[model samples]
Target: MHYALNVYGADINPLAVLISRVRTARKVEFAIGAIGASVVKRARADRRFGIETTLANRDKWFRLEVLTELSKLRRAIRSCEELWARRFLWVTLAETVRLTSNDRTSTYKLHARPKHEIDGRNVSPIDVFSDLVSRNADSFAFFRKKLRDANAVSHARYRASTDIALVDNRESKKCWADVAPFDLMMTSPPYGDNQTTVTYGQHSYLPLNWIDLADIDPKVDTELLRTTQEIDRRSLGGRDPVSNEEEERLFAASTTLKNFAEALPDTPSDGHIRLVRFYRDFQASLEAMIGQMRQNSYMIWTVGNRNIAGKQVPTDTVLSELMEHAKCSTVTMLTRRIHHKRMPDRNASSATMREEKILLLRKR
Candidate 1:
């Protein structure tokens, strides 16, 4: 068996780069799976790219098969798009509301909706659903025609065709863990043990119910397990410690949490210790991520500081120190005055925070 090396030379086409990267990513995944070992821990211990080599010989065949299947899946998603988009509208709106309360913060009173309201403009859930549902109809025929016309100038087939490479690893930690070193790492780490900024489980329920997106069962990811542990404080509407309620509606389990906490003598009485534990846990995860990165890789982390007991715990500053301690070189710290779309409403007396400090760290 022979393999063709994908290289972008001086006569480069943008599409070629995308297709080549997609193909390379797929081959890498097959290689990792074929290794039959924990690639992550192994990668940390020893940088190995052999699995990628073994799969490259059959890369072309695999790419063609996967793309054909993806085209069909895309068609199916388009077929039921109307209902899919409509249902996604609520889910998208719910996503705008960041569910922040941990199981320990649950209360019996009406939960105050955060002040942050999201603007759903042109690509609203309704529009997405409508376009998807009417894929076969002539309604979007003009748009489709225009798209095809715009894409026709290229002589590239594989170059112009972009693909998503999904590798199924039974021992992966996060959703995109197997995805090799990305050119850019832009993401927000989980905030504390509370689900306040957004309950990953709750916000995703709408998308899961309506859209035909890939299997993103949060339960499948071990990183999400930490979230489940945070929300598993008390049983809802029952005396038992466990309840069979879905994770998305775990906020409704707040009342049950307050009851459980009130019953405990060492529940910190003021909720300060919980913050400590949460931040500490977050720092640990960040360290693990640092360990996984290639040397000199950049990490963009966006986090905010909230008022707790009238003392501002500058998580950004604390995290900076932690990152440096973890051997991550401190790059420029960028402070942006962006509003937390889910910033909670504060009383006249409570201290309010309205900005996030973006930290850029480089792994050494």
Candidate 2:
């Protein structure tokens, strides 16, 4: 069987080179499925690609044959011996979904899914899986090294408190919570909801559909993939757009958001609502995170400015303002250029983004 090698160019980050050197070289091991060319052709005729459903037309981006073969391969992997190895194979399969699709973008949460005129974007399951197997070997090696370097030993497992409003709920020790404050934190929060910005949920949807939840972890929520948009819906701005929500407190919290809302054009009211809902939810999350940090700790906030209604949303500036309200002063801000990303690039708003902002802050 012939397989193509995807070689990365020198344009990649220098850190990637360092990680590659540290990763212990190892042979890529994988379970070879009985899915042959004939099996693939047979599956296409077998009809599982939603040809008759409302989603039938999506075949333009995701060919029926490719989808069926992938589905067949994934479902069969569950019966394979060595549960841990099987789970890893399933993750590799999920990672290859975007690669096998006809869409130009490698990632999803499209803001909106686009229809491609070209019909040759679909890749065979064999090729996609093969490429992923090769990639995973190196990826895992680097991950192990990183974990070793960070000394990521197991810590006490405690489910996050369900209610953000309960900051002083004195029952934390009873629940075996990690009341010990964190020394530092670094996170790249979402630019907005998955539906509009990255479509992370949509990108994850196909892979989750193929991966059995029980194999990953018993605690894993199967409900997250119940709907194609379920994860995004559960995320900020995942609900139906409505302008009547009492978000005055949200507007009052950040002058940047307030000013942006006022300047929004009288079109796509849903967009307006999406922005408000996302920021409001984000504010709640920020407050929750702040509560977990030690005094005078360092935090690094990586964010991007997504365009909405043909205007650049001042994310870094707004974060600075919002953090001020949270009592964290911004130490400095830096801009990182995005060279080549797989995210959707067609949307005038939130797509075709070139740079992301990093905000270094200190908790007072």
What's the TM-score of every candidate structure?
0.44, 0.70
Whole-model Cα lDDT of every candidate shown, in order = 0.36, 0.58
Give every collision pair in model 2: 108-199, 109-198, 109-199
RMSD of each: 18.7, 9.9
What is the Cα root-mean-square deviation between model 1 and the actual structure?
18.7
Encode model 1's per-residue lDDT on 10-86: one tens digit a residue.
10111222223333221122121222122122323432223221212223212332223222323333333233232
Against the true structure, whose lDDT is highest? Answer: 2
Best by TM-score: 2
Please state the error at residue 277 of candidate 2 in Å.
Answer: 0.9
Query: What TM-score would candidate 1 get against the native?
Result: 0.44
